[model samples]
Target: MSDALEKAEAAVREASTDTAAVQLAFAAMELAKAAQQQAQTVPQHHQCEHQHKPRRSAGEWLGIACAVCVGGVGIAFASLALAILGGTAAIVVLVLRSMWTDYQRKGR
Candidate 1:
């Protein structure tokens, strides 16, 4: 099916000398090997007839929002207590923002 293979076959047929036939055979083998390697290295992608995943439900979003709000309120009270006891509120905000950014990136 390959042009190189077709050309090599033609060359072999036309070759009068043993050396010419051997050289053509070697060329064809190399071409076949390269093609095989390419097939192995390249990932084969198949298209789906539909979407990969169903959309998230509204109830799921509401539940997630509720959990987040509860956790956030708890953290705010904890961080306030820590700040009152001479801890750094700025560091808490920085760490929480960094974690949220990482979570957003991973979700995408």
Candidate 2:
């Protein structure tokens, strides 16, 4: 940037017309100002691109496994209870229907 600015200064001094010299000087000043600003600016620290996650411990995994087992057992018990309840309901319905037919035959 300094080298470019020096070249621009030389060009402006060697320019024949005042108008051309003034334009070249203005351009050099803008370049120098930009370089100064860039130098004064602070550099930013780069962060890791990937996310950081803590790994699960063995105890946590064991706890999760135990919970899954308990859930499975609970579901099994619920299924068994539903089967029993359904069987009992079917039996009650069959008994009631049989009694109804018997009563109707007796009335006839």
Candidate 3:
């Protein structure tokens, strides 16, 4: 536990007057709040400052174009072809997601 918490406990344990206990309790609360703020925060320089994620790469753009073309062609062929196209698009999207995640992990 924190030093402030230990002190708070000691204050509570040894209190002789209601006023003294209240003052100690308030001090303990402020300490707890300060500690919480410190623990929850990160340095501004350590955070992401970009307004948006970087643009997709050339290969990623190409993949998106192919997916869009497949979707467009599926519109002309109707039900069965559309379903196949949708499934293919789903698989491609999953593969791309895994690739992106791996790329990010490696970069980190």
- lDDT tens digits, residues 1-108, model 3? 699999998887677477787999999999999999997796677878669878999999999999999998887678878789999999999999999999999998
Off by over 4 Å in 1: 1-51, 87-108
Residue pairs with backbone overlap in model 2:
none
Better of 1 and 3 by TM-score: 1
Error of 1 at 91 (Å): 21
Top-down lDDT ranking: 2, 3, 1
lDDT per residue, candidate 1, 45-105, as tens digits?
A: 6535675787889999999999999999999999889877665667788899999999999
Indicate the TM-score of model 1. Answer: 0.33
Clashing pairs for predicted structure model 3, backbone only: none
TM-score of each: 0.33, 0.54, 0.29
Give the Å shift of residue 2 in candidate 3: 99
Residue 78 displacement in candidate 2 (angstroms) = 0.4
Off by over 4 Å in 3: 1-77
Model 2, 63-108: lDDT tens digits are 9999999999999999999999999999999999999999999999
Q: How do these models rank on TM-score, best leading?
A: 2, 1, 3
